[model samples]
Target: MPRAWTLRSRPNGMPTADNFELRDAPVPRLEDGQVHVRNRWLSVDPYMRGRMNDVKSYVPPFQVGEPLEGGAVGEVVDSRAEGFAAGDLVLHMAGWRDEAVLPATALNKLPQLGVEPQAFLGNLGLTGGTAYFGLLDAAQARQGDIVFVSAAAGAVGSAVVQIAKAKGMTVIGSAGGPAKCDFVRSLGADAVIDYKAGPLVKSLAEAAPKGIDVYFDNVGGDHLDAALAHARKDARFAICGMIEGYNAAEPMCFRYIMRVIAMRIMLKGFIYTDYLPRMGEFFADMGALVASGQVKSRDTVVGGLENTPDAFLGLFTGANTGKMLVKL
Candidate 1:
């Protein structure tokens, strides 16, 4: 018998382990054009927190008593699909389960990137895709631009820092602690702000006295307000995630939102799926960066399927440096 995590209940505020239940599930027989996979790695991301709520968003909300889903990399155990075979590694969204029986169309064959298969779930997958598209396409970051990134030690933020640096942009990153600030600095940030130390807006103002040309927002609320205040005229803002307010009981009010008009800031929210058509471009660019050691892959891996809920909960606690994963 295989085990999978189910959404026991909708979280009131911050999610707890009690909201998830691990139950034994039967692996369905492989039908035509279907394959059975034994997941090797499961991804736990901040965006999944939004999915837990019963809301109308880009993706549907997770249903109660049903298995939660996210990215997973696994080896094929049995296949009735034409293009796939036993022992082929694949990536899919049937995670939170030890084994998955899904259609071939749902699985993407992992490319031989000279890296571990788990890399597909981090630097070479959605994590990388989000950062790449968000920074380049959405934010339109250019060489010599001053870019400010929030949650700079997290998966997407770290990538944003590195990508901006690689493109010759001056980057300032904001993280929660000394260690995370150090990590962000190591990723080539011109300056790193310890948001936990003092007021975020004050720290950002001090770091960029001339105002920022672009803002890559991962943590919303105060971070967003800080970016709005310090934005240069006609600055571009790529709105990625708002992990700070994800579990909040009430909406966060922005005091500097009025500056959006005065500064002529372009704030845009985006989903990675919208850039799926350019996935080949992402792979070619990011793969080369990773291979050349320009863009590094960092992850915090929790062992076992049972701890998946803990890994997911850890996102809000800054328990992960980069991408968080569960080794199944």
Candidate 2:
């Protein structure tokens, strides 16, 4: 018998460990056109938090008693599908479990980028794609522009910093503490603000004396306000995630909401899947940057399938940095 996590109950505000239930899940018999997969790495992301609640959104909400699904990398143990074979490495959306029986159509073979298997869960997968499309497409960041990225030490944010620097942009990254700020500095940001040290707007102002031309927002709330306050006219803003208000009891009220009109800002919300049609372009460019050592990646790994709930909770508590994964 294998184990999988299920949504035990929807949370009122912040989710707790008790909200998830771990139970014995028997591996189902593989039907025709199906494969049996043993998950090697499981991804935990901020977006998954929203799925826990039973609400209508971009993606459907997770059912209260069903096995939770997410991105994962696994090796095919057995396959009834024609193209897939035993021992093939594949990426799928059958996570939150130790093992899975899935249709062949649901699996994607890992790219031959010459990187580690879990890199797909981070640098080359959702996180990386989110950063690339959000900054370059949604924000319309260009060379010589000053870019401000919130959650600079995070998976998507770190990628944005390196990508911006590689393209000859001035980057001002905001992270929580000294260690995170130092990590952003290593990513070649022109300025790294320790957001926890003082007022976010004040730090951002001091970092980029000139108003920023691009804002890559991850932790919205106050970070959104700060970017709005300091945006140069016609600045483009990519609203990727608002993690700050995700678990908060009250809704976020931007103090400088009026700046959007006054500064003529262009704020757009987008998801990485919006660029799936351009997948080949992303793979060619991002893969090269990664191989050239210009773009680096990191992960905070929690070992075991049983600890998946804790690993997911860690995202809100800042318990992990870079991409957070559960090594099963």
Candidate 3:
């Protein structure tokens, strides 16, 4: 029997360990067009927090008592589908479990990217894709632009820093501590703001001086407010994630909403799936950047399946510098 984490109850505010129940379950027999996968790597992201709640959003809510799901990389152990074989590596959304039985249509064969399979769960997967499409397509970041990225030491934000630098942009990243700020600077950010040091708006104003042309928002609330306050005319903003308010009991209020109109800022909320039709373009460009060493993958992996819940909770606590994963 394999073990999986089942949601025992919907979270009220921040999730607790008691919300999840680990249960041993039997692996289903592979039927025609089905494959059995032994998961190797599981992704823990902030967006998953939204799904845990019973709400109508871009994706459906996670049903209580069912296994919670997210991105995962695994190796096929049994296959009844054509073109898929035993021992083939694959990426799927049947995560939060040690083993999964999924339709072959739901699995993507792993690419030989000269990186570990888990990279598919991080820099080379949705994490990187979000940064790629959000910055280049949604935010429209360009050469000579001053770009501000919030939560710059996290998975998608770090990628944004590298991609912006690769495209000849001046990048400013905001992180919580000196070490994370240093990590952001090492990723080619022209300036790194320690958000914990003082007021974000003041720090960002000082770092940009001339105001930012583009803002890649990961942490909302104060970060968004700061970006709005220091935005250049015709600035573009890509609203990717708002981890700041994810666990909040009350709605987050903003004092700089009027700045968007006054500054003529263009703010857009986007999901990577919105640009799925153009994924080939993303693969070609991001793959080249990664292979050429202009873009790099960074990760913080927690070992074992039992730690997956803790790994997920850590996303809110700044426990990871890059992509956070559980090596199952």
Candidate 4:
């Protein structure tokens, strides 16, 4: 039997432990194409705040009384599939469950790449991949270009800062506090903006005396508007997750609609799943960076499956410094 966190109630604004109920159940049997896995680590991200709402999203909403699932790293305990074998380390989307039965297609074999396995859920997984494709493909950053990123101390933002620096771009980052600001600077960001200091527009203006050529937006709301104001002509804005407005009763409207057209910024909103096709290329490049020490990966890990709810809810309050995960 495995214990899992199931949805107890839909969250109103911010989710608490009350919204989740932990229950135990027998390990499921593997179907024809499925593999049984015992999860080692589970990830909790801010974008999941939107999934709590009973609204339509790129991914389906979490149903009441069902287990809440997300990215997880685990080991194959039983396999009914060809490519996988028992004891093989794998990464897949299995959520908060201590054990899961998933189709082989949803699982990827983890390389013995010397880095921490949690990096698969952060740096080399969806977070890092999102930053890689979003900045390079969507934002089209060029050498010497100036770039600004919101949620700059976070998993994905940290990856963006390093990738931009590696590409010879001047990167500026906006984070909530001085600690995170310094963290981004440590990741090679040319400038760091403390968004909690004052009006983001003013802070960004001071940080970026020259207009920014690319804006990788993760925390939307006023941050998006501020980036729009300081953008250069024909700048590219890769609109990723909007953690800021995820808990609000209503989604925040972008006040810089006119600026998008006026500045000729090519703004594109994307879900990380859209980049699944390029995961191979992402894994190859990002894996090389990790192996070579160009990119740094960090995880704030909580021990025990019982603490999964706290880890999930902590994302809303920016409690964790980097990627938030629970070790089962």
For model 3, residues 1-328, the per-residue Cα lDDT tens digits are 8999999998888999999999997887779999999999999899999999988999999999999999999999989999899999999998999998999999999877677788787777899999999999899999999999999999999999999999999999999999999999889999999999999889988899999999999999999999998998999999999999999978888888898888999999999789879867877888889889999978898999999999999999999999999998
TM-score of 2: 0.99
lDDT for each residue of candidate 2 in 228-326, tens digit (9 for 90 to 100)? 999999999999999998888898999999989989999999998899899899999999999999999989999999999999999888887789999
What stretches of model 1 exceed 4 Å from their correct place?
none
Residue pairs with backbone atoms closer than 3 Å in model 1 (clashes)? none
How well does candidate 4 match the true structure in TM-score terms? 0.96
Which portions of model 3 miss their true places by more than 4 Å? none
- lDDT per residue for candidate 1 within 115-142, as digits (tens), equals 8899888888999899999999999999
**Candidate 4 residue spans exceeding 4 A from truth:** 253-255
Q: How high is each candidate's TM-score?
A: 0.99, 0.99, 0.98, 0.96
lDDT of 1: 0.93
Clashes of each: 0, 0, 0, 2
> CA lDDT of each candidate?
0.93, 0.93, 0.92, 0.88
Give the Å shift of residue 79 in candidate 4.
2.0
